[model samples]
Target: MTRADAPPRPENAAAWPRLAVVALGLLCLTEAAKLVAFHQAGPMPRASDAGAYWLLGAQVARGDVWMAERPVAYRTPGYPWFLGAVQAVCGHWAWCTAIAVQYAAVWVTTVLTGWWTWRVSARPWLAVLAVLVCVLSAARASHASLLLTETWFTLGLTVCGFLLSRPGALTQSRSTVAIAAAWCLTWLTRPIGAALLPAWLAIWWRDSGVGSGGTRWRAWPPLVLTGVVLAVGLGPWVVRNAVLFGRPSLTVFLGRELWVTTFGPGRPTAGGLPSTPEAEEIIRRASPDGEFTDWGGNWSVSNRLTASGLSDAEADALMARVARQGIAADPLRAGLRFVVRGIDYWRATYLRSLTDYDDLAGTASDVRDGQREWGNRACHRFRRAWLDAAPERNLLVVELSAALALMGLAGLWLAPSRRETALLVTALIAGIALSTAALEYPSYRYRMVLEPALIVCGVSGWPVLIDVIRRGSRTL
Candidate 1:
């Protein structure tokens, strides 16, 4: 539909109240689920990454932000710092308080997702539907209850999307800076934010009309300004890493991650790595039973290497060298795997069975088991079934994701030639998928940060599909 054919845009006064009500309703439903799930899982905080996060927070609380004994470069300090503040204020109830904070972030993300949809599609109802999709996402809701980076990254991503989608955002200095700041924060939360830079640049270039007639030089300044903003935001962290490790690096674990994903056990053998007997021997000696896994898994070769003799920086460099060798041995296979990983990334999901809760009262396990037995009562079967199902393969997740993917694709195809909004969203998805695949094996949870953009794209396409179906039915 043309601009004139679209529904009237709601003014700020009318929109805020309605949006607020919708957001509150979502928060209520999500909180209810969280209470049930938390009760079911037990009060003890699950230790996957949460343990590391909590430890980092504890360090922060003690005024040791540098984590001198353990380099802070292993993980970014943003989420831990936030958790530290919660720990400081809430004391014994810190985990609970942190969960509450995460839920609030989810609510903010929901609101921004709705607002962005409305702005892009000019359809209020669809925008609301998009908000519902985001709030109801089992994967997203589950993450909010855990101490993880997903919630913060999701909020930052949605806010950034909303800002970039706004008309004249690129030309306006304040909006440009805001966008840059949001993107930088997202990077700090998770390295994936770096991949999103191109999408933002694409939008800015398209909106600014840089090549149409104006001096191409105009494009250079905004890009430079964005770079400077990011550099300034990251300056402290970079400086600390350089001074502490004597090398400039974003994170200490990237090389280790690359090595493990490429050449370690369980690494896809479809693309074989060249036989490097020396490096292979080193890895085998480091790993337990010659197997490699993530930091959380047993026989973590990376951790063993550090414990055995290598400094964090040296171990990282060793892994990087091994990873590069593996990739060099089979670039064709690596390239193919990257593509396959991109496809697998979307199909990934979080399993509820694995969620760990750190229980403060030491009653978490008993309480969880009691709740499970209590839920077995006939009255609770419906809720019990809902909670027990695998979150990644849950019918709701599978169907909704599939619908969004198909419809979002249709929407992009049906969208106007001059309209670059859909294309920009597509670019963001592509950037995320490609960047993620390049760094590590694909997992469902890795894609959580991109959920907001996915929902927006999926919702935008629904109207187009309905229009096509109606037209076909009338003709028939």
Candidate 2:
């Protein structure tokens, strides 16, 4: 329409779109910077995991059981399967393609974050601002560029939040089906993502018209959808374990790991035993057959030893057997150790034992011939540098994260309802609590699902800070 004939658009009408465009640009820049700055993916354990994922993908590519490979067994195939998909698509350029896909995923996730914050707060500028801050943060950038699953899982989580936020958006059978499908995908994306099952159930219960006369018909649709999706996503793994191994299950990776974490002997150290070994031992000794694993217990042992070695598994089993006998022999010490180890899992930095490397000696020659040689050297360098410099690095990131976290805390404090603020916080805390209670302490990345929530809280506080600044200016 001609200017004279057209009505003026509302001022806010185009603001969100403009902000979104800016956010996209910033997301691109941040991702580009990440690709440049930390292109190699710093040192071992991280590199080891990266290599293991690539190895798993390679194994899957060759038609081998992706779940049955070495050193590679610590992780599930969920992520590498995605990586393998990209590799299949890209042929010899698989690594290149994988990195590109991951970069795009990170940007998409960042944009989604901006859009969600804008949608919820209706503050377009604040949304972009949050995206920029997250992208520039070195910690986030480092993780985003890696061959790790954390970024992808985090992206799925961000998208899931965006999807769930739309009230009654999944009411229709088809829509609820899609929601259930998405959750299944999330779980397939990361085992811990199954935690979202409870989260979604909460959403379903909250949104479902359960008490209405037509509730049965209404609920039945979504319930059936959830079942179908869960069955399909998890069914194959179950069938594989059952047919091949004679045990119907979704977590074979956990079974061997639980055995390793408990009864396995580890490198002698000044500490009585590593917390992981100690916990595994406690559980192993407690079990009747000396098997540390108990899938029924929310796969508690599974999660604990997902990354542990055979030795760790053996130690875990032995410890559990000992603990069970000891608990029968003397309940007090076993109970105390569990409590203490659980706290350690919460408070101690889990970096110490990540590269324990109690068993890689057999492959040392092969490792030298493979990419792991350089990776090992890099890891050693990284460890030396990290241990030497971690104090300063820790101080810096801690201070910044803590300050932002406080901003989030204040924003949450000022929210209209205490319960409203508590939802995300409580869910995050519960997840952390479960992780601590069920598994050993992990790296900073385990808490990643909570970062966006924290960012939202911090973003919410911007208005209060602005208002304070405005009042001070007026007085001046």
Best by lDDT: 1
lDDT of 1 at 183: 89
Q: After superposition, how far is residue 46 of candidate 1 from its true place, in Å?
A: 4.8
Best by TM-score: 1
Model 1 bad stretches (over 4 Å) = 1-46, 264-299, 356-385, 389-391, 395-400, 468-476
- Model 1 lDDT tens row, 161-225: 77887777787777788889998898888877888877897787776687477677667666877
Off by over 4 Å in 2: 1-24, 27-33, 40-47, 65-75, 211-217, 253-392, 395-425, 461-476
lDDT, residue 66, candidate 2: 43
Q: How accurate locally, in lDDT, is each candidate?
A: 0.67, 0.54
40: Cα error in model 2, Å: 7.4
- Model 2, range 128-185, lDDT digits (tens) per residue? 7778766655444345445678777777777766676566645777767676776677
